[model samples]
Target chain A: MRTTHVGSYPKIPDLPAPGRWRTAAEKLQRGEITREEFRRVEDEVTREAIADQVGAGLDMVTDGQIRWEDPQTYFARRMDGFSIDGLQRWFDTNVYYRQPVAQGRVAWREPVTVEDYRFARSHSPRPVRPVVTGPYTLARLSQNRYYPRFSDFVLDVAQALNRELRALDAESPPLIQVDEPAILQHKEDLALFREAAAALLEGVRAPVALYTYFGDARGVVRVFYELPVEVVGLDFVAGVRNWEVLESEGFPQDRRLGFGVVDARNTRLETVDEVLRALDRVSRFVPLDRVDLGPTAGLEFLPRRAAKAKLVRIAEVKRAALEVTR
Target chain B: MNGLPLFPTTTVGSFPKPPYLLEARRKRLRGQIEPEQLRQLEEQATREWIQRQEELGLDVFVDGEMYRGDMVAYFADEMEGFAIAGLVRSYGNRYYPKPVVVGPVGRRRPITVEWFRFAQSLTGKPVKGMLTGPYTIAEWSFNEYYPTRRELVLELARAIHEEAVDLERAGARFIQIDEPAIHTRPDEDFDLAREAMEIVTDGLSAYTITHVCYGDVPRIYPRMLDLPVHQIDLALKNEDFALLEVFRQHRFTKDIGLGVIDAHSHRVETAEEVLDGIRRSLEVFEPRQVYVSPDCGLKTRTIDETVGKLAAMVEGARRAREELGAG
Candidate 1:
């Protein structure tokens, strides 16, 4: 029952300033470098990033999503139709990533690599919140070049993820976080989101978490509360105005609040006082344990050094949270 | 001529670039398609459009944005601190790039100079040099890096003015700088915009036109008229006419491009109604000083509707011409 960022950090190679993660992955896959060598590199990157979060005094830690790409199919080996394609534009900016798409039906390209899910669990020592791209967001992002309705496709995606989450739950992961960033953009389609949320966590045995970032809930958090989710996440940065809407419209008491106060898009590091103030105000409505202090979105939008700095700040806020709790 | 009636019309930009032609432009960019073949495709559309305009006897001939790839997308290649990652699928799966303003922007060289020169060459009638204004570019960008949005706009203004002077050198008598995003910011930026306008039209010749529409004109109109542009094309089709009094108050020295045609709706405005809109303009502008053109670029519109609307606009002007002579 906690919060985290969308999982997957591009593992940096030991060599001074590697070209891209793919080139490093290729060297390993081609047998030019041993798997142990690749693991060491990823291990260094993740351990340093996780320690930064822990040092920042963050209550929860994500492996900085260092080794995941798109994350929808990182671990699921069996699915109806899905695979990685040639590099395409992610939001049509200067940066490019190899895009994942649904080839036929919504299914997994591979099994959930339980390594990061397990590694994060082991790495945090403190409670680690497992973050995955939500089924609905994945369905909406991937083209319907094959799948018909995104709702139907997301249902299949959610179903496949259930197996992964259940396996993580059996391994005793504390929380599973679903990254539904696309919901803010598709505010008008609330029913589809509710249905999609219900579908993804359908059989997940773990305490389920869902995070929405980058925009306002359109004051539509009311519709979201109706989902069978235990904790609902929102980006307080953009959704500041929507809080009033949440106050006016009632929320389900069964759900916890994952309040996103840190801004992931910008490089500015937040202080302990600012994080404490947000935690205090958000805690007034939800119980102290029900709220997690974290950034509004993923650190992927920032450069590696800045991203690490922000996570360090997250840990600081978590310490502030403990002080408030005591 | 000063006492004679004035006419103005407009169309939204981004005329339908068929996939074949779009691919051809991409090919040209990649060095696959020859400049001649690309010219042939654009020229094919341009020549036909001008012929239709002349046949209809429209006063100014717009080349219908035949050569430019996308209104905002074209800037991605020219500017720094930004990169075209991928397209934004909005308004029903129409993809446009999310122009991430990852840093500050600067110009590389002239973007629209060659095509505008080519367009001007095809028609004997006066040609309209089309440019997307800096404010629009700034508004459309993510602009997260800038300390203030105004700085980014001013930076864009410098870049826009660079191309505008080039277009003027390329034989552009009428440069229509599009500023549909001007009003989106707060009211305080208007003065800054006025200063930027002076910079954009700084070395330009006569007949600098600023195309603006779909916002409160009373606040924007007077501030805009104070700029260096010779004519202001205002959206009158879906706006209040009371603001025309602001121009009447200034004894407006610059001409007005009164958008008598409704570009938003598909229903073609009747020639009589468009003429009626012109009669209303007579109250503000002296006849010769008034010009007729679309409210904006015809880019999003279908080719047939553009021609039909332009033909209707001309027919309305013919009516205005006949009525003014009689009056």
Candidate 2:
């Protein structure tokens, strides 16, 4: 079995005086540093985030999404027909993200995350996966002023992100992951999400991961089979019902599984024995070879040290799973 | 409560700490200063804020929470069964020491009563006794000891209830229990939040207010009215009073701490803009039910911005009262 992270890793490392990145951000805001200077600081931390994931023995890694301000505004600020507004709490967490307001017809101006994806690919020793916030989540979380119908807004965002995906596809990344954690909360919009997902994955040749977190995907798990994606990722920690659903109704055999076993939100460490037991149970339904061990969600909810440690635990679990399969 | 005028103005709770107080807090962390020295500075800062609010012509006052850090962490540091964890990111470029519940949580002493008494002594106006709600304290913290979320939340509610009773005894007429995390899991945990609130304000004599901000307000509305409190304080200005649309559908039964100023913006709102927000709120709520305030706490802003925003809020409320011929 292989291992990978959901998406973000902490930008700041665990250090006694790791105030350089924060100071640089403050300076950029205060007009004390150039935009290029701020980019240099972001690049430095991005390299550190990549190194941490690589050192933890992951099969594939991301840029750690260190450059992202938050999941929504990072892409929203770069796209056309959108403006950043006041802060809103992101789901149930203590963390907040700046709300995005769609002012006009949402369209792709240029490649938003392609440069960051290329940067991660060039810096990492392992193959890097490009992660993007899914269209359904973008539409749900944002304030839509232009589109009278929510489906139009969601599809517009999907088509816009499809252009970005095609740009990243040119880079020939290992895989593309689209996070739609918001779908877990609004299950009635499954048909809308399916349409948006098809639009998002249209021309991309790379294998795509449709991942959901922050809650159970039990309501929308059946629809995952119908979506045009290679892997279906579900959170098993906060959304423990996903496991119950997996037992009652097995996942599709044609699709690979992103086995999210580690608790990403909490700092608690999982033992190898405990993970092996969960892996053993999951192996009954899906083949262990078709699974990728990962955290329940992005590791950004944790501190740098705990996030790194969780990555290491995943690697350890993967090694034990391989031995058990052997 | 009957002595207050219509459109009475107040703040959510905290104000920005002065530069000197911030430095003193840092020094105290590093053991360069004693607890007593830090307490003296905190008292001074609290007094300065009290005087500033009085000068700003606000009808009610807050202690400014000058002695506190993260709302959850401050209480966790004093309560039993909690251990402070390392820094976790709360949002963009902001981090806090998240509390980890290691055992059964309970309060040994009355937290915030001493500060409430001290701030009340300085102000003739009723100083609000600010306490983070039990649901928020449990929600924001990492729980390891409790078998279930409800157990931890209820235990926290009992502990916070004790503090609320102490504040009422300490001559605080307004007790603001902030449950900013209330709407986080509105579908599953909202009823639990209401249940925990019932334990908190069961028989409290003070005019209780619960401040919930910056989430899906539309989902929790009408249902949020069921929360057992005298007032439901909300951050409405940042959302541009979009929540008023929900209130139009269901009549707001309780007094509303109407947020008329955007607390997050660096550009101070014009008095006209704040007056418009108050006017919008008054459309749905009675003039007496409307208590003018900022969207949330002013701690995230600079001192200048905080003062500017609150000043505009007061001016706008004064205009609103005049428009109603209640001044």
Candidate 3:
């Protein structure tokens, strides 16, 4: 449950670079702007945020989730068989482009888009995580709209994304991170999550780090240990005891383990020493090369300034801690 | 005695305590004032809140949660097997380190009656017996103990259920279980949440209600159709009124506590806007199943804003009733 040495955090010091538009998202519900207009603003704002993170100096950098509407939303847009009609009111905490439960057979109406993602990759020479909402998470979260079974819809969406990821693989850097935040919602879904995960990820050749946030991984920490995935991410903030489960459940030592000790949703910054203490504890489970670092969840919920400031500290402290301690 | 109509219009449950009462309660908890004195102060605040709503001609009123602690923390303490960790600095000096849920909860004593009685005693209005729903209590706590999140919630639900029966036995007629956490449910787990909810609220005798906001109604839809609660108090003011058509399609039969006022906003909503909201609600929901209320709670709002908005909501409901010839 504790890190013995320096571990990974979304130590990335940048945000998404400035750019332009494509799909619809939950932002449309907020009436902040039209979907097309939002795409452009977000693309650019994302660059600014990433620049800010890079300016701060940290380890790995992502487009700060610049390409998609939400983790699951952009993926939904790529495929067409599902209708946006059945989604319950947008999400309760964070909004997403949700599809309602149908016959569970998920089909894509449109070809998944990726130009803006390549645009994000173009932002810097730094190692960036090409983020994709995991196919299992996407299918699991969306309503099939017409499908009869959850797995059927989930697997279909997963297979399509595998194709997308494989294409993404042909074009860009090989690292693709799949966010499966919903996996923590229940225990029963852990095995099913692994199964569905294995499917969507079947053809992709990149190193995959499956991520879950906001709650405990108590149910499926074991499935994660055995899954064919290259890495696994666990939330350590609100999910106060997920680490204990991981320790008890036993994850593979060779696979990369993403330790999320930073509080992404809250504004208060933890002292460098405090974070180092957490990192040190996580290191106990895996060596530095086998661990990645990041917040417990997305940096979206925190006010932009707070999130930026937090990343600043994360980047700085990580450099000092890793250099001296490791 | 049954005190109110099913799924009545009321606050989600916190009221800003008058400075003096808050000071006194702090003093009382610190062993300064006697329980009787604290009781008097709560009753006084409850009287004022009730009178304010009565003056607005509200059909049902709450004592504005004059007696409970902060909504999430109160229930967090009663949860079973949680090690009350020493305070973790949350935001500021207002230190509230939650108890880690390490095991199952078995309620040993009553938690919210003294204030419910004091409020009901002072008013002729029907008072709401409010409690935080299970899903919320689990979500708000450090969920470290349970084998799974669902089991953790079911334990909390059973505990809340015991409280509901106690309130009903103690002359309470209506109950509202606030569940803003439903908004946080993963898009895929709506039915899992509903399943847990049904188990927790299985046998409550009074009209049970759930208040949640800001999610696609469909995430909870059709699935919510099966919950044990008789009514759903939801937020609608921030979104366009047309967003409500989904509920109509589902033929949701439960009473709907239509939030005519946006709780997150402080600007006093005009009567016309309020009426438009009520009208929009009526377009989709039958009048009998509709009860006018704020989208969420008033804790984040000022006293004046709360009063002003409630007044606006009541006036709008009256207009709708008259226009429909149901008055």
Alpha-carbon lDDT of model 2: 0.89
Clashing pairs in 2: none
lDDT of 1 by residue, A36-106 (tens): 88776666667766776666556577787666544443432245677664333333122334445677776
Regions of model 3 farther than 4 Å from truth: A1-289, A292-326, B1-9, B22-39, B78-80, B83-97, B186-189
Docking class of 1: incorrect
Interface RMSD of 3: 12.6
Ranking of models by TM-score: 2, 3, 1
Instruction: Kindly indicate the candidate among 2 and 3 with the higher lDDT.
Output: 2
Kindly report the fnat of each predicted structure, to 2 decimals. 0.02, 0.50, 0.12
DockQ of prediction 1: 0.04
Error of 2 at A238 (Å): 2.2
Per-residue accuracy of model 3 over B268-325 as CA lDDT, tens digit each: 8887887788776766777678777887778667788888887777777677776777
Error of 2 at A35 (Å): 2.3
Q: What is the TM-score of each candidate against the true structure?
A: 0.54, 0.96, 0.57
Q: What's the lDDT for all of these models?
A: 0.67, 0.89, 0.66
